[model samples]
Target: MEPTTTTPPEPRSRRGRRPHGKVRRRLAGALALGIGLLSVGALYSVVEPAPQTAVAQAADAATIAKGQDLYNNACITCHGANLQGVQDRGPSLVGVGDAAVYFQVSSGRMPLARQEAQAMRKPPTQTFDPHTQEGADNLAALGAFVQANGGGPQLPAATGEALRGDDPARGGELFRLNCASCHNFTGRGGALSSGKFAPSLDPANEDQIYAAMLTGPQNMPKFSDAQLSPQEKKDIIAYIKSVSDGNNDVGGSGLGGIGPTSEGVIAFVVGLAAIVGFAMWLGAKQ
Candidate 1:
């Protein structure tokens, strides 16, 4: 009691200043924590996603989540929230696997421009191109999300030239037997009934051809491993490449590779023109 009486009252400013300093320190710590959290989130978003060797590769939750986001934004309109597909707009993607996705999307045939007899290839969506890591990551994520919902045909581990086989001769036989009717003997493509047509293979790369065979995009029939062995598929690819690269155009100009009908037409036109000119010359001489 005596000490209390002797002690002067603590200054109001000092008391207030100490409490204010403590409050400032707490606020500063809170701000630092918030910044740290933001930095971590930014880091995660910027990191590159891994590429898949096979479409069946299991995806982590984060990747699936990212894919889900992409689907919701770009695909939900036609493909639906669950990928069941919106009737009259898009087909059900239940059994269509990543192979289909890669074929349709990577080739820019999907996210359809409009209702048509066929989805034609064009420049791919900026996010789906496989040449860039970001595009590849996005494509992988979207494919993963679709695959997670329903497993389907997975792309092979091998890609590019690795998919080519040793025997172009055998490949030519297979191609003639299975693909020539629609794709033409040289893969130049041809008209089908209605508005549909077989798209030319000139623009397609090796992976695209493989994916098309695996998924049977558009009117093309799916060639399962049971129907065509992997080696056989490779051979077919080699044959296609050989023809596509002009290596097999040993007969000179392929004349658009439209086959003998075009050659016959050209021959007839040239012969007709020559005969007409000859007749005119004879009349002039007479």
Candidate 2:
């Protein structure tokens, strides 16, 4: 007979392997594993999403996120998580308005180093250069967040020198009656009770002046919209800008325009002359 034992039934291991079933099992497992790997990658993609798309999809949402991040880093300690404010640290920001936020934050009155009688307008903790893309966006984001919260005053849509009042004279009158005590006639800031002092209006822009008047930051008393009409505020700003932009001292050199400067100069000159005269008299006597 032919080699009837032709196949010793292969080896037991090979015999145990059903080629068809084994290949099918392997293909199915590989397909499942590949799908699982792809799913994992997709999940990772979702967890770390694309920034541009997120921003485009919901600009306001993105703004809120950015504002929240900034708030947490710089404001949470003083202002509570909900903007309620910490006792003796910061007052609740709610209902303070975007005008207040813009005035305080843009001017760098916020993020104060330590609690004081009044918050001073030093160089801002965060600067926003309108020329830069990122800075403008960040500033807008912060303003938006505050606006979204309790509503109050708001910054005007337009900003420019043209916004000033037609008459600087009228503006001057308004300033003297309302602002001269705190800020000098030329808008030079002055000392107040305690550590608090009114800051110079030199650095302030028109919008900032308007906002400050509306909000009344620190120890400065609030000037409501009713108290000072918008036109009056604009007039005050015009006067400030006119004086700040150039010397308004119609008389001799402004010399700081503080009353004491000229007084001191007169005293020095007079005293020196008197001393010289006294010395000459003593010499004649000798």
Scored by TM-score, the top model is: 1
lDDT scores in order = 0.87, 0.79
lDDT of 1: 0.87
Instruction: Provide the TM-score for each candidate, comma-separated.
Output: 0.75, 0.69
**Backbone clash count, each prediction separately:** 0, 0
lDDT of 2 at 124: 61
Candidate 1 per-residue lDDT, tens place, 184-262, comes to 9899999998899999998898889998999898789999999999999999999999988876766567788876366
- Candidate 1 residue-wise lDDT at 145: 81
Tens digits of per-residue lDDT for model 2, 47-144: 87688777776987888788778778777898898888899888898988878887887777787756768776766643454335775676677777
Q: Which stretches of candidate 1 lie over 4 Å from their true place?
A: 1-59, 260-265, 280-286
